[model samples]
Target: MIIKRYRVKSMNEAITRIKYELGREAVIISQRKVRKKGFLGFFSKKILEVTAAVNDPEEKNKYENSSTDSVENFKKVVNDKIRNQKRQSDFNYAQSVNLRSENNEALLKEVHQMKNMLDDMSKKSYDSLGKSKLELKLENMDINKKVIENIMNKVKEIQQDVEEKKKLKMVIGNMIKVEDKVLENAVVLVGPTGVGKTTTIAKIAGKMSLIEKKKVGLITIDTYRIGAVEQLRTYADIMNIPFKVVLNIKDMEKAIDSMKNCDIILIDTTGRSSKNKMQLSELRAFIDRINTKNIHLVISCTTKNRDIDTIVNGYKELNYNNVIITKLDETSTYGSILNIIDAAGKPVSFVTTGQNVPEDIEVMNSQKLTELVLGEDIIC
Candidate 1:
C-alpha cells in the first residue's frame, strides 16, 4: 500500500484528481486539515491538507510492478538528460573545431601573402641592380672583381628592411659579449672627450669593487684636462679604490707595473676631443704602452648624426677594438649608429644609459642593440 500527503487550496479537488489518476481502489481517502493564520490570512485565502492511501490487491500488484518500473524510469530520465547534454556538447565542440580550422587557414593565407610580397621585392631590387651594373659596365668598359662584388653587396644590402637590416648588422658587426672574457685585475678605458669615458670607467670600476669584491685601482691618463684627474680621484675616493696620476706613456707603463697585483686596474683617458688628431695620437701612444686585450671606444648617442662619421673617422687611426655608445637616455634617434657601424668596421662593446655610477652602464651585446635600433618591427 502507498500513502501520500498533499497541500492545496481545496481538499475535494485534490482528492478528485488523485482518485481519477490512481483509480478508486488505489486512492483511499485518509484525513484532512483546515489551516487558519489569524483573521486577515483566513479571510484572504483558503487552504487545506489531504492524505490518501492505496489498499486494493490489483493496486498492490500495480505498485509492486511500478517499483521495478520506477528504477527503469529513473534510468530512462537520466539517459535522456545525458543524451541532451552530449548533443549540445558535440555541437559546441564541432563549432569550436570549425572556427579554429578557419582561423588557421586565414593565418596560412596571410603568411603566404607576406612571403610572396618579400620575394617580389627581392626580385625587383636584384633586377634594378643588374640593369644598373650592366649600364655602368658598358658605358665605362671597366671590369674589376672588387667593383663587381661591391655592386652586388650594395644591391643585397639595399633589399633589406628594418628587421633584415638588424640581422645584417649583427652579421657585419660581430658584436662580442663583454662577459665572454671578463678581464680580471685590469682594464683600460680609451676614447675621445665628452663620450662619457671617465664615467664609464668609474661605473665598471665600482661594479668590480662592490659587486665582484675584487681589489680595484684607477689610473688616469687625462692629465691635460683641468679636472679630469680630480674628477676620477673623487670617484675613486668615494669608492675607496687606489687612484694614480699618469703623466705620459712612461707613467702609464710604470702604473701598470705597480698595479700588477691589483684585481682590476681601470685606466681613464683624457676624454681628449677626437676633432684634434694630435690629441688622439697622443692617447694612442699611451695605450700602446699597456698590454690590454680590448680598448673600448666611448661615443655618446645624443650626438648629431653627421658628427658620428667625423668622430669615427678621427678615431679609426687608433684601431680601437670596440665602440661603447653612451647617453642612450638622452637621445631618440639612433640612425647614426648604423652610419658608425658601417664605417668603423668594428662592433659595440657596452652601452651606458645614465649618470648613476656603476649601475647605469651595460654591455651592448647583439640582442639589446638590435631591439633598440629596430624598434617595434623586429620580432620579440
Candidate 2:
C-alpha cells in the first residue's frame, strides 16, 4: 500500500488533497488535529493532519482492468440466461398449445385490471389540479415557505381534480422515505432525553417479534437514568424477549454476543443533551462497538423548530441517517417534521402517533404524514 499524510485547514481540504495526490481510490486511515511548531512551540495554530493510503500501482491497475471485464462478463451471462429462458418458454408454449386459450383469458384479465388502475390514477391527477385548499392548509400548518413552494410547484404541473386529500398525501409522502424492512440484525436508537427512545424500542421489538415473527432481543445502554434499565427489562419480560444491560464497551459486546442468534436486536441508548459534546461522544463510543448501520435518531414532533434544528445539528457528529419523529399526537401542527427533514436532509423511518406501544407506531408513509400535517383525520 502507498501511504502518505497531508496537513490541511479543513476536512474538505484534506479530502481534496488526498484525492488529488493519492487518486479517488485512496482510503483515509486516520485524522487528527496537530499544532505547528513556532518559536519553541509556544505559539502555534492547530491544523488537521490526515493519513491516507492507496494500493500499489500494479494491484490498482489490475483491479481497475478486472472491474470492467467483470462487468462485461456479468452482462453477457445475464443476457445469455435471459435468451435461454425465452427459448425454453417458447418450447413449453409449443408443447402446451391447448393451454394458450386459458392463458389469453388470464392475460386479458390482468390487462383490464392494469387499465383500471391507470385510469383511476389519471382521474386523481386531474382532480389534484386545483390545490388552493392544499396551499392554504399548508400555510396554516406552518410548513416552511420553501418546502411549501417546492411541493406546490411540483403538484401544479399535474392538472387533476381527484381526491385532493389523497393527492396531497402522495405529494407529501414523496418527500419522505421509510425503512419498513429490517436490513440490519442489530438496531440502535439515540436521541435527547424524554424523546421516548425506550418506548419506541419496545414498540419496534414487539412488532418485529409478534407481527413479523422475528426472534427479537433487547439491549439497553441507558445506565445513566435510575429506572431506565428496569423499564426496558419490564417490557422485555412482558414481551418474552431476551434483554441485557450494558454500561460500557465490554458489556455492550458481551450483550450483543449473547443475542447473536436473535433475528433482530433492538438497542436502547441513554438520551444525551445535544449541547453536551462529551456525553454524545461517549455514546458514540458504545455505538461504534456494535458496528451496525441501523442507528436511528429519535426526536419529538412537539419540539420547536429552532430546538429541532439544534438537536439535529448536535447529533450530526453521530452520523445518523434515519430519523424517528415521536409524540405526533401531542402536537397540533407538524410543520416541524418538514423543517427537520429539510434541515437535516435525513429520511424519517417511523412516526409515533400516540403512547400506545406497537399499535400507535407506524412506518412513515408520505400520504398519511401529509394528511397529519394538513390537520385532516388519518383513518388508520
Candidate 3:
C-alpha cells in the first residue's frame, strides 16, 4: 500500500490528480479545507487537502521491473564506455610500438650507410692494412702527407717480408741525403728572414775561429736590418776576426777579396721574404756573383712543411747545393728536416740545436735524423 497527500483548489482537482498518478483504484481516505500562507499571513489562499491510498500489487510489480531495467541499462552504458576507452588505449600503445620500430629501422639503415661509405673511402685510400698502419704512424710523426705517400709507394715496391720498420729505414735512407762536410771554402748562408742565419753564422764563425783555429773571416750582405752590420761586427770583434759589411752587390767582391787571407770565409746574406720576387731576384743576382760550390740554403726546423717548401722553391734560383737546419731545439718535429732535404734534393750539412755558439751546431747525422723523423727518439 502507498499513501499520498494533495493540496488543490477543489476536491475534483484532487480526485483528478489521484486518478492520473495513483490510478483509478486509489481511494480517498480523508479531505479537509486548508490554507497556504506566506510570511506574516499576508498572502494566504484557501485550498482543498486530500489523502489517497493505493494497494494494487500489479502496479507495484511494474515499478520494481522498471527500476531493474533502468539499473541494467546504466550498467550496459558504463560497460560500453569502458570497452571503448580500452580499445583506444590499446590502439595508442600499438602506434607507439610501431613508431619505435620504424625509428630503430631508420637508425640502423643510417649506420649501415655510414659504414659502407667509410669502407669505400678506406678501399680507395689505403692499399692494405699494414700500409694503413704505417701511414698512420708516419702521420703521427708529422711527416708531410705527400712525402708519406711517396714513401708508401716505395714500400709497396719492396718485398712484404722485409719487415715494416727496416723497410721504412731503408726507404728513408734512400730518400734522405746528408753531407758530412761541415764548412767549405767561401760558403754562403741564405734563406727567409728570422731563420737565425746571423746567429748561425756567428756560431760557425766562433767554431772555426776559436776551436778549429782556422783563421775564420765573416762577411755580411744583410745590411737591410737595423744593427745588422754591428751585430756581426761585435761577434767579429769578440773573436778578433776580420768582418766586412757589403752595402751593395759591387762591394761583395771587394769584401771577399779583403777576407782572402782567412782559411775560410762564411758569408751571411739578408733574410728575404719568400713572397717578394723582387728581393729574391736581387738575392739571386747577389748569389750568382759569388764563386763557390758550398752555397747552403739555411732553413729553420720549426718551419711548417708547406712554408719550408715555399722557402725552398723561392730560393731555388740561388742554386744552393747544401742545406742547413737551424732552431733544432725549438721544435720536436724533424719531418720538416727530411721534407726540406727531399724537396731541395740536397744534403743536410749542418743543424743548429740552440742559440749557443759553437756548441749547439753539428754536422747532419742522417741515421739519427731519420730516426727522429720516425719517432724513435726525441730531439734534445
lDDT of 1 by residue, 266-329 (tens): 8888766678888888878988888666676778776655677677788876777777778877
Which residues of candidate 1, in runs, are more than 4 Å off? 1-181, 377-380
Q: List model 2 lDDT by residue over 1-380, tens digit each.
A: 79999888999998998999999999999999988867755567788999999997887688777777777878888888878887888778675665776787788899999899777665543334544556667767878767888878767655777666656666677776656755458898999999999999989988888898889999999989999999999989998999998878978888999999999889999889899999999999999999888888899988876788789999987888799999988877887787777767888888898878888788867666766777775423
Task: Write model 3 residue lDDT over 69-125, tens digit each, in one string.
Answer: 767877887788778877887787788778878987998899999889779657544
Q: What is the lDDT of candidate 3?
A: 0.85
Error in Å for residue 257 of model 1: 1.4
Task: Candidate 1: count the clashes.
Answer: 4
Ranking by lDDT: 3, 2, 1
How far out, in Å, is residue 266 in model 2?
Answer: 0.7
Best model number under TM-score: 3
How many steric overlaps are in each model, in order? Answer: 4, 10, 0
Query: Candidate 3 — which residues are off by over 4 angstroms?
Result: 1-131
| Candidate 1: residue pairs that collide | 185-263, 185-264, 186-265, 193-271
After superposition, the stretches of candidate 2 with alpha carbons farther than 4 Å from their true spots are 1-136, 149-171, 378-380
Q: TM-score: which is higher, 1 or 2? A: 2
**Comparing 1 and 3 on lDDT, the stronger one:** 3
Which pairs clash (backbone N, Cα, C closer than 3 Å) in model 3?
Answer: none
Model 1: lowest-lDDT 10 consecutive positions: 138-147
